[model samples]
Target: MGLNGSIPPDIGNLSFLVSLDLSWNRLHGGLPKDICIHNKLPRVKELQLSFNDLEGEIPLGLGECQQLEILDLLYNNFGGHVPREIGNITRLTKLDLHWNNLSGTIPKEIGHLSNLEFMDLGSNKLRIHPKRSREQSYTKTQGNLIQSQRENCVLFVFTF
Candidate 1:
């Protein structure tokens, strides 16, 4: 489908909607602020808006969707800090926000997501706290892997 334009707010009325994948489209505009209000998307498990032209901050209300397992917004024009409220989604397993225009520090709260298995925030201006032990380990692991192919690899690691 060649869906274009902002996501309509009425779509949130689907009380039982589980997943919303509008990726690989020509969709533009930011997500409606109220779309993720409490109980609006009660059972939503996956929200994929990748490869679109969607711009604006990733809504803070999205954290209200406690059941979200995968949130992929990569390859978009979304800018602003990664919302710390997203850490509230303890069930999130995969989060990919790479290739976006987002800038800011990686929220420390993200490290609390023990269930996160796949996270890619590359191609953005985000940085991690080098003092955090957990982040250091993660950086070292990533750095070592990349260093194997290139002798001089400068790593700017972030925790999530």
Candidate 2:
């Protein structure tokens, strides 16, 4: 069902929550700061809140969710840099933050997500400004794949 209101902070009390999909809804307001507070979502595997009217930075506490595998926050109004804390969730595989108002360089910590399979940071205010040594390392293997095709892609880089 599609809801059209803010999520209750008490909802985070569901310590047993395994998977939550709140996509394509009319929900507004920022997510609860305690949604994953204190490692609350120990069993959570997937959390999809895409295509909604939600705004604000992703809750910093989400990094405590050690079991998270898929996190989809696409097409929202979220702003600010991707949280470095998220890189602490070693179990993450798919992370989607596309089509938001985020800015700043992609965090180097994201490169540490060894399990990440898919990630999309396109269509936002984000930029890519890599240091020379890092660019050279990637260019050697990836062949400078990022062309100056789009204005927002001025410093984009790809790593396999």
Candidate 3:
């Protein structure tokens, strides 16, 4: 559907939704914090909402989707720290938050995600606070502190 306009909050009503891919659309506005209201979306493994105009922080309630594996929110306008609560999703393998306006240090809790292999937080205006790298294993490793920063943006990556 070549739909226009923002996503309806009632989208949370899709209790059985598994993979909600709404990429490359004209969808604006932020995601519903209670998108998984009524304990729904627990079964969701992949949520693809990239290349749109999605602004605002990644919802804190997204942590409720414990089974989320691939969260693609690239090339958008999402801001704020990558929510620390997201670290609770241990099953995530590919967490792509590239090309956005996200700021603040990526949560240290991300190192706890042992299963994470591919993560891209590149091309953002985020800060690379020393604290976020201090406890992370990737930074401790030989030399895995990859910084593919954009024009004046310092995008730090800690992959393990």
Best by TM-score: 1
Estimate the TM-score for candidate 3: 0.82
Number of clashes recorded per candidate: 0, 0, 0
Residue-wise lDDT of candidate 1 within 1-160, one digit each (tens)? 6888888878778889999999999999888887779688889999999999999999898888889999999999999999998888899887889888888877767766667767777788787645654432134355322111222323233433
Off by over 4 Å in 2: 132-160
lDDT of 1: 0.77
Give the alpha carbon lDDT tens digit for every residue of 1-160 in model 2: 6789977888778889999999999989988987887767779999999999889888888888889999999999998878878888888877888888888866666655666666677777765555523422112224534333222322333422
Winning candidate number (lDDT): 1
**CA lDDT, every model vs. true structure:** 0.77, 0.74, 0.74
Q: What local lDDT score does residue 82 receive in model 2, on the 0 to 100 scale?
A: 82
Task: Kindly indicate the candidate among 1 and 3 with the higher lDDT.
Answer: 1
Candidate 2 overall Cα lDDT vs. reference? 0.74
Which regions in candidate 1 have their CA more than 4 angstroms from the true location?
Answer: 133-160
